[model samples]
Target: MNNAHYELQDGIAVIRLENPPVNGLSYELRRGIVDGIKKAEADDNAKAVVIIGSDRAFSGGADITEFNTPKVMAEPTLPTVINVLDSTELPVVAAIGGVCMGGGLELAMGCHFRIAHPQTQVALPEVKLGLLPGAGGTQRLPRLIGIEYAMNLIVSGTQVPAAMFQGTPLFDELVEGDLLESALTFAKKVVEEQRPLKRVRDMKVSHPKPEAFFLWAKTSVGAVAKNYPAPLKCVEAVKASIEKKFDDGIKLERELFAQLIQTPESRALRHAFFADRAAGKISDVASDTPTREINKVGVIGAGTMGSGIAINFLNAGIPVTILEMKQEALDRGVAHIKGVYEGRVKKGKMTQESAEKKMGLLSTTLSYDDFKDMDLVIEAVFEDMGVKQKVFETLDATCKPGAILASNTSTLDLDKIASFTKRPEDVIGLHFFSPANVMKLLEVVRGEKTSKEVLATSMKLAKKIKKTGVVSGVCDGFIGNRMVGKYQTEALLMIEEGASPQQIDKAIEKFGFVMGPIRMADLAGGDIGWAIRKRHYEEKPDTRRLYVADRLCEMGRFGQKTGAGFYKYEPGNRKPLHDPEVDRVIEEVRKEQGITPRKISDQEIVERCVFALVNEGARILEEGIAQRASDIDIIYLTGYGFPVFRGGPMLYADEVGLINVERALQKYRKQTGNPFWEPAPLLAKLAAEGKTFN
Candidate 1:
């Protein structure tokens, strides 16, 4: 069946787009629109034409599922359908409501006239997928609106209300209510008045100081989009609008779009986009699984992590009761929560009243008694098993039956944590990244004993709190932390050999990470890693110790908190400055180990660090710790600041070719003689078979 419905309403030919859930313009939908336009043109009873969609979306643009598929470029493509609309002699009015983005807006621009709901969200967000609008968006948008406004919308990929374009030629009318009625009336009026076919291509586009403006735009966009080439291409496409004729401008836009599609940056972005969506789906857990209600939440501890966790639920409008051991600690936690809201208000992100309203949902106490009625209780106490045991035992005793007992443990085993509670079935892990309120990733650890209902509820709650929840089976560090351990180990090993912290950081940062491993370690606090290493010493004595990091901890150069780490931080400043003292310490440690310093290449640094992650990730996939390779990618993308333009380690390895990655691992193994440098079985097998991680 066609994805559109055509009918004669009054005297207007109404062709309503019927693709549900944002109405992505898939091939079938594109074909339906083309057929409807033909039918409208042939009908004698129809006065004019109106194209409409559901209340949720006018159209959300090209179907992502169809990307990299032949169906995306099938006959009657989005551009072809829009060409039909442009050619039609009869007045075609786009009655847009809800989301009208990318090709949807491009399609609307092709029509004779346009009317939209004031609240409709409009954008050309193709830039986010490392692309410019390929279907006449660049050529037509500047013709409707000015160059500056159109360029800003396309390059930034931000959404704005359709009302923002009310006075512009982009919208003929902005209706606040009953969009269909207004559209039909507008269509009839167009017919009665014999309005000429108003194609956007016929309109003139001009800009003041066009040369200067485009030059500045290119430079600015280039700086912001340092690694990715699409944003700069977007500027070029927009520049073509005024520099060339309409058809010629569209040709340039298509050429640039095609070039970007072939780029690895664009490929990686598309992979990440699909991987993010894939991460939410569990193979064994049915999408329609019933989830337990989580209306009231109880948080144990009032430290930074605990407070951040509470803020998330409070922001989501859930009532929270935060418990602490002492009243002073409780007061401090409450103050921290208040300060966060106050800061938001000060930044003009929210109203003071709104902040107060959210804070009003918080209840602070020093007793487990307050958690009796909580639907869910998450313990964000110290990451000690003994402390966790006490907290869970108390929560199990105090919380109402069936209340989910979740632990906010980053590295501890979820199964062991579940064993602490009597209702192990109600236990799950909700591992929030540092600064929990702002981070996007939440590893929803599905313990062996965790009920499907509880697991589903945790996933649902992750979405409710606006987090990208990637499910991980219980392991020492789950997926992200486990892989990162190997990544950090390689970085430390490089530093010990010859590479300075600065060189290692710059290499990885250049490789597209937001921050380098050494900088991240310093910012996160050297003490934290030291503690983890101490534990590793007891648990796995055979594991090699990172002596340099241990020596730094001994020096009490904790991090930004203590004002000194691998690099010195000036008071109130986060910039990492070179310290001669740090260099001296490194040299001393190297001497003690009877190791001679040798120059290491940046390429070697990047490979050792990133490949370490890929190797561990392969093991993670083999062990089923991560359900799929894409899930691991999501963890790194959302949690670990992995470059979105390189996809994630797994996909990056695939792009690098697993054979090349295995070769690099072998090279490292022979040079370093480290057992950990060995390629994972999965990686080796995939390389041998000439298969990708996918």
Candidate 2:
């Protein structure tokens, strides 16, 4: 059957696109559309043409699978298809609903008139994939929606509801319901009125004082768009629309779009887009695996982590029962949850009623009996094994049969925790990032005996709470923290070798990290890492005990909580300030070790810290802790604030050429004489083979 079907109704020829899901405009669909339009033009009884899509989408732009392929530019390309629609003698009206984006929107704008359902979302999100709209979107959107508004939508790649643009020329009319009937009524009226065929290309695009407006826009867009070239290209395209003829403007748009598609930044962004989707798939679990229902959740402990975890379930409209040993701790946790809602209400993000409704799902308790009926119970107690084991043992005994037992432990052995429960298959790790309510990453650590249903259900639940869930196999620190451990270790070692905290932070920040390791450590609390390190030292006796971190802990500098960490903080101020006393301590520690400090270059610092991550990530790949290299990238890009433009560490290493990365590690291995600098076997082998992790 043809992807697009042509049918006549009451003197109006309706063209319905039949491609499943979002009807991606491939060559076949493009041909079908062109044929539909010609059939309407040829039909003696048909007075008008109405082009639309399946209930799901009008068109979701060009078929991405056809990208960089000859079929994309085959007979009747997107531009050629749009041209045929524009030339049709009948009044062609676009009936848009669901998703209309990129070339889809461009196709709609090519028609004589456009209308959509009220809730339909419209966007030209090509910029998000590191390319501007190639199909006259830059030129036509401004003509219909004004220069400033078009620039905002095109540059930021934001989605807007069709209702928001009711008065704009982009939409001829918005139907309440039954789009076909309303469109038929609209088309018949157009026939009666003898409405002339209109084209977006014929419309004049104008901006008030074009030269001055463009100048101001360039300066503002340039400020936040240092790394991305597409947004600025979007600016230049829109600017050309205002200055040049319509045909010239579109020519400029196509040129800029083609150029961006080939750039490395665009390639990285495209890779990131695919990586995020691929992260959700587990190799062992089928996509059709059944997930257990999750209605009620129980959180053990009412500390910061527990409270944050509870808020996620509550926000998802799932009832949450939080258990704490003391009423004081429970009160504080409950109050913090309320305070969060109150803050959102004050910020105008949520109404008082909505906040109350979300808070209504929350309850606090002092007994595990309160969790007897919960579908899932997550223990967010102390990170120590003994405490977690005890909590899980009690939960396994208390929670009803088949209930999932989860631990929010960041760095402990998940398999050991799972063993504590009688039903090991039900025990999994839901490693939410700190301040769980805000962060998107949820590392669903699957134990050795974890059932496929439990893994599938945990992933489903993660989605309900609006998190990007990545599955991890049993291992210390799992995916994110495991790699971050190396990143942090290198930073501490770098500081000891003479790079100051501020200099190290600045160098990484310049390289695209949100915060340097030192600043992030200060924010997360230095004590957290100190405890983890102590565990490591115990597990592996050869681990160093007297690092610079231990000295900072001994000085009672925990982090933002203590107001003095590696860097000092004044009362009520969380910003790090240079402390000469800390410098003195570093010098004293260096003198005690009988080693003189030497100046370290920023390049060396980046190599040490980043190469540490790459090497550890390589080991993770070999061990099957992560499903693929892209999964590791997803963990870092979403959780650890890895630079999006450079892609993730694994991709970044591949881009840097594994040979160069191997050379860098070999250099550090020889120069620093630290066993940590030794290259992973996988990294060395890949470098030798001239291959990438991807």
Candidate 3:
């Protein structure tokens, strides 16, 4: 298909890119632009040139599909095409609208003049993929705009509307009408007056006390850069445009861009970019599947989870009705949700009127009859199966016909819950993470009888509430929590074997996790997991085992709420302070098991925790609980605080080599006579065959 098209308008040669969706500059598109420029320059009748794109997008960026392919560096690259456009004799005007970003913005910079609509979103966001702009973006952008503005834009990879730069030289005019017509008129004015070529390359990058500002910028960028190097490199490249000559800065930009592309951080970030996009697609569900309209939502229970769940739909502009057994309980739930919004208002993150508007969408009830008008009803009651069955059965009888009934059960069986209702197809799970309005993950649990329309609508509603929706087959703990169960188990086992909570947390934190399992357990409250563990033992008797966590709950120390758990916390501070009493509890458990404590290394702690996630993830894949390896990565990255720089646990395992992982598991099995360390069959097979999950 023709990615770029050329047409003649009066005496102006108009070149427009036709790549559907986003007009990514591919090899063919580059060739078209280069050839079109040459054709326009050769024709004496064409006194000027105008370039434009469709209303949705002028261009988003370079065609990432061409990355690492011969087509990317194939002759007539983006720079080559831009160079010809920059040096063209006929005056050219860039007409920008929608999303014009990265290489697209770079191409616009090459034109003699630019005209855009006020709402045009313009950005150079290569920094998000862990690389600087390779094709003259860092060099030319600073020359057109000032160096400081260029630094902030390139470093953050943030979008700025064309109107934000209205008075700036980056755009010659802002057109509210047809951008193409305005651009053509701008081109005619340039030709009528015979305006000299206004190439961005000839412009100078100015700054007051350049050396001083760069010194400050380096220190600032370095502080926030953390494990990622691309942001700092972005600052350096923009600095080069000011310190070095323009051509020399271009060379340095290429060198820095090439260096960053090879880093593991860059590879992981690129994987993340693709994984997030791929997670939304369910292969079995066709794109044309009709979704149920969720105009109103209902939530049962007035506890933390249910209240938070109501806040999500309310924030999404959907009216929410929450039910409780008593009027006081209902009032408390409403107060908590309102307090969250009020806090946002006090923080200046939202206006008082805006917060009130959102809170106004919420309603409370004491009877199931009020849920009759709700298009969807989510039960966020306790984790007990009996409670869930009662809720589902009542919802089954009381809800309006065609209403989607969803359970917010994190680890419970969705299929069994579906069995409580006659229309099992309408019953699915919308597992929102803790503090639902704040966290991004929404694991849409698909039961055995879940209809495609229901599953699709749940995913759609997830996006409506600003959540990253990942579909998971009905299973105990679903995907994120199921894998985390194993991960936490490793931490517990390591503690029993010898390592202290601080030691394990330190090793994992150094490995890049923000919160270690022990600290996470404490923050979430040990009583939560203690209850879950009790439930596990009740449901599956054979897996019953005594552990140190039960001791913490027995002492009535439940995380931040109780001011103590595995660690002690000072009144206001949430920082974990080591407790010898907790260590004594662990020591007593080890003595009860008739085992002596052994010295454990940080490497073992890191391996056992991360590999535990990997092993369960493999089993999940083989069981078809997760769609693909990348989808699992997305779940962990978004839901849990798995380090983004390592991709997800599955991708990290692939990076570590599955063979090495199997060997480590075998070593642990031999060290401790536990059958749980046995390598998953899928993992062992993949390792032997030399394969990656992705």
- Scanning candidate 2 in windows of ten residues, the lowest lDDT window is 543-552
* Candidate 1 collision pairs: none
TM-score of 1: 0.98
Candidate with better lDDT, 2 vs 3:
3
Query: lDDT (0-100) at residue 424 of candidate 2?
Result: 94
The stretch of ten residues in a row with the least summed lDDT in candidate 1 is 390-399
- Candidate 2: residue 468 Cα off by (Å): 0.5
* Candidate-wise lDDT, in order: 0.91, 0.89, 0.90
Q: In candidate 3, what are the lDDT values of residues 1-694, reduced to their tens digit? A: 5577888898999999888689999988888888788889888899999989889988898987887799989889888888898888888889999999999999899888999999999999999889999889999988877888888999999999989888888999999888888988889899899889898888988887999998999999999989999999998999899889988999999999989999988988999898887888999999789999999999998888899999988888999999999999999999999999999999999899989999889888999999988899999998889999999999999988899999999999999999999999999999998888789989999999999999999888888899889999988899999999889988988888889999999999999998999999998888878888888898899873648888779999888889899999999999899888998899999999886889999999999999989989999999999999999999988888899999999999999899999999999889877788899999999999999898
Candidate number that wins on TM-score, 1 or 2:
1
- Give Cα distance to truth, residue 85, candidate 3, Å: 1.4
Clashing residue pairs, backbone N/CA/C < 3 A, model 3: none
Mark the regions of model 2 whose C-alpha exceeds 4 Å error after superposition.
Answer: 65-75
lDDT of 1 at 227: 83
**TM per candidate:** 0.98, 0.97, 0.97
Error of 3 at 183 (Å): 1.3
